[model samples]
Target: MGEATDRSGGRDRFLDRLPWLLRWAVVGSACLLIVAAGVYVLARIAALLAPLTIALAATLFLAALLDPVANWLRRHRTPPALAALATLLLLLGLLVGAIVLVWRLTADQFSDLAKQLDQGLTRTRDFLTSALPISPGQLDEWTRRAVSGLRSSAPDPVTGAATVAEAAGALLLVLVLLFFLLKDGRPMWHWVLGRTSDRSRPMATHAGGAGWRTLGAYTRGTVMIAAIDAIGIGIALVILGVPLALPLAVITFLGGFVPIIGATVAGSVAVLVGLAAKGPTTALLVAAAVIAVQQLEGNLLEPLIMKRQVRLHPVVVLVAVTAGTLLGGIAGAFVSVPITAVVYNVLRTISEDRRAGAHAPTGAPADPPSRSGPGDATGVAGS
Candidate 1:
């Protein structure tokens, strides 16, 4: 009994001597581990439902972008379902029209782009041979081996066709989900809240509503930024007389969805095209223009537009995009920022609630006491 008492006493002393901050840190670490484990399990489930997950994500993105329009129509006395359907159809029509327009504008330039790329590659090889110690024969052999390797690893037609079919099916599923989400998303969210305890219901609602607004702002702002980038770069390319300017600008617009790397890649394409068709001076000018545009965007456009929507630091955005790409590829990169914003907003809401509760006064009466009590009159008389 004495030994047990001594052990218990020692343990108590050890705990007592621990710093309060250290104790909280330990608790915080455990909470972080639990959160990470939950996320891992969620990711595993998502992998199992890849197509459905993609559809759901795409639907959420579209709904975020179109919810305002639907709400406006609803306020104007349109039926909710009809409003959602109209919004979705209008978005789809615009998307299809944009695709067709880009296609028609670029179809004649495909051959030209290929020819320029081939010429560029040849010139690059010649430059390398002349500048370095490499013989033309050695460079030719390396190029031949690289081409052979690429050809060997390329997918067969059957596999490529199947992949295309899968993509089309996923796209169709996304459209269907988008329509329903825009129409019934509010009711769906309320139904989810209804399942939770009353204490948690308000927190969940606030987080969800705030997250949706953030997402909406992000989508709209990103589109505007991307358009500006494309137009700026496209106009510069045209002034410089770069070949394939239209196609490159369209690519730049699409690439904006992926954040930093997308614009870089698109701009690089413009530079290369210029190099092949318009020589070194034109290539240098195009590269300069691309850099200037990106610099302006990073410094001015994103800060102003995305400030209210996404409060993420540039480093956080880059890390999120990188991790998403590694884990989920292109689609992951595309949604990474929005997902991060939602998670951040949810955590912020929970933290704020906790802080407010902590600061609330204890032992407060539910209501003010009546002024007609005998004790109140006696106290007043004594004073």
Candidate 2:
């Protein structure tokens, strides 16, 4: 009986530890599965969406940014659907007008560029004939070879057009998705909560609210900053006499939405155009203007607008941007900051909840005040 009791005690100890072991195993397995699933999904999405992914991401961002406007309209007695439609129409109209203006500007610039190219080619041929080591004929032969090589490597028009059509289809899908998301966002949240167990509903609600707020703040702040950048840079470029300045400004504005790298790319384009049309000195000035505008946007506008939304350290943002670039290129870069913001908010919410839960009462009675057993009247009288 003694031996049996000892064995039973040992078995109970093992059983107590069994749950811990299983828990660790379960957690590890879940983590591995999650990582694998994330990788697979990312790859699939990249392959399937490609270019349209950028537009889709932009749409979600815009939706989140514009959510407040929709809510305000609803508060003012407008239906959610109508509010969403109005916001969408307003945005679309502005975008279309901007695109038309840019298109016209770009067409004119291209015509001018073609004429310049012809003159430049003629001057290059004459210079080579008169002063270069290579004969004009040799130079011409080299140019022909380069052109042939480029033509050989060019994409087939039919295949390229089909690919473009596919991308357009994907873009249409994104628009449809964005519209539904904007219209049914609240209902979807409630539905998600309703589907969860009662025990988790409160946590879900808290987390959802935190996530939405973060996304909304990021979107709104980014848009305001982008607008400021666009206007400032547009004016600067126009003053610099940059060709296609309007189109370049529009591109800069749109690019600003993608954070660090986008602005740099757009600025490079502006500089190149400035160089082509107005000379190197003008290009340098344009580049400086780009830098000045970025500095203002980064230091002043962003901090003011995003202080309440995301307070990520510069290092954290840089790291996120780097990781995003590695993971999904431009789309990754665009989404990284928002994703980081969401993560930060989630962590904060979880920490707060944990602290609250830790401090909550457990319904146990407090221990009686310490005293000598059967305490004397004076409490100290007992010895």
Candidate 3:
């Protein structure tokens, strides 16, 4: 009996080690396979979707942003299709109005700019004649040569036409996609769930709901912040007597939509306008005003607005933005925040569900069924 007990204990020890050895081997192999497959899939997708990727991305963003308006309209006795159309029309009208207003206001500034450019060129020529070793004839020849070089290096007509066609196609795709997404978003979600297994439906629903809420919150909060930033900057520019103030304000507002980096670029433009139109002192004041406004938006406004809408750590946001810039340049930068929000919300929802399950009356822990042997036994025992 003692010998039999020893043999059984020895068998159990071997069984324990065997499972672990298999687990590690399986895990390592699976990880390698997954990495390889991911690379292959990503390469395939990039090749297939390179042409339409930008437009698709823009469409998705617009759909996400406009979804709340559509929902609000639905609540107010508007059908989904009509609500989407109405929202689109309202947005279009606002854009048209702003464009017209800015153009009318800035016509004088543009005329002045043309005169200023001519004066600057003359001054540059005079300065070069006085200071440089080259003769005026040589300078003129050099200028002509530079102009010829630039004209020669300009994009070919064929390439330019192709680019224009692509841009137009992209715009059309985005508008079409936005309309359908706004109209049938809920049905689309339901359809996705229907395609999945019943066992996964509840988790899918939770994840989808959480993701949509996070996206909606992010989109609405961003628009609000952008509007506030634009209004504050526009008022300041106008008060400071900045030339082309309306256009500058529109630029500032649009730049705010690009997030941290866009605002800085817009502010730089404001300062440049201040420098050109006003003077160094006014430019300095404009720069200071921009810094103050950005501080307010970043510290006070953003935190307050985004508190409940997928709260990411500053580090996470910075990292995501960096990765986004690296991957898709400006478009990546614009989409990264909402993508981070969705990912954070989904993970958070899953984690919360697990925690709640663990704390439920049932004694079993809220972990997936274990495929391991002694490790799982040890874990259960410890619990």
User: Could you tell me which 10 consecutive residues in candidate 3 have the lowest summed lDDT?
Assistant: 374-383
Candidate 1 vs 2: which has more TM-score: 1
Model 2 lDDT tens row, 1-383:
99999999998897677778797887899999998799768857874766676776667677776666666676688776777777777777987897787787678778687665465456546655776688867888998999999999988999899978977786777666666766677666666667989765555556656676677677777778888888899999889766667777778887876778789998998887776566557778999999999998888888888856576887887788887787787778888888888878867765666666666679743232232211111111000
> Best-fitting candidate, measured by lDDT?
1
Badly placed stretches (over 4 Å) of model 3 are: 1-48, 116-156, 363-383
Number of backbone collisions per candidate: 0, 0, 0
Report the lDDT of model 1 for residue 295.
96
The candidate that wins on TM-score is 1
User: Can you rank all candidates by lDDT, best first?
Assistant: 1, 3, 2
TM-score of each: 0.85, 0.74, 0.74
Native-to-model Cα distance after best TM-score fit, residue 300 in candidate 1, in Å: 1.0
Instruction: Provide the overall lDDT of each model, using Cα atoms, as 2-decimal numbers.
Output: 0.77, 0.72, 0.73
What tens-digit string does per-residue lDDT give for candidate 3 at 1-383?
99999999998887677878797897899999997698567645754676587777677667666766776787788877888788777767987897888788888788787665465466667766887798999999999999999999999999999989988888878777777777676666666778979756555666666676676677778888888888888888889977777788778887876667789999999887776566566778999989999999998998898757566776877787776776667766777778888888778776776666667677664543222211121111110
Clash count, predicted structure 1: 0
lDDT of 2: 0.72
Misplaced by over 4 Å in model 1 are 1-11, 16-29, 363-383
RMSD of each: 9.9, 12.8, 9.9
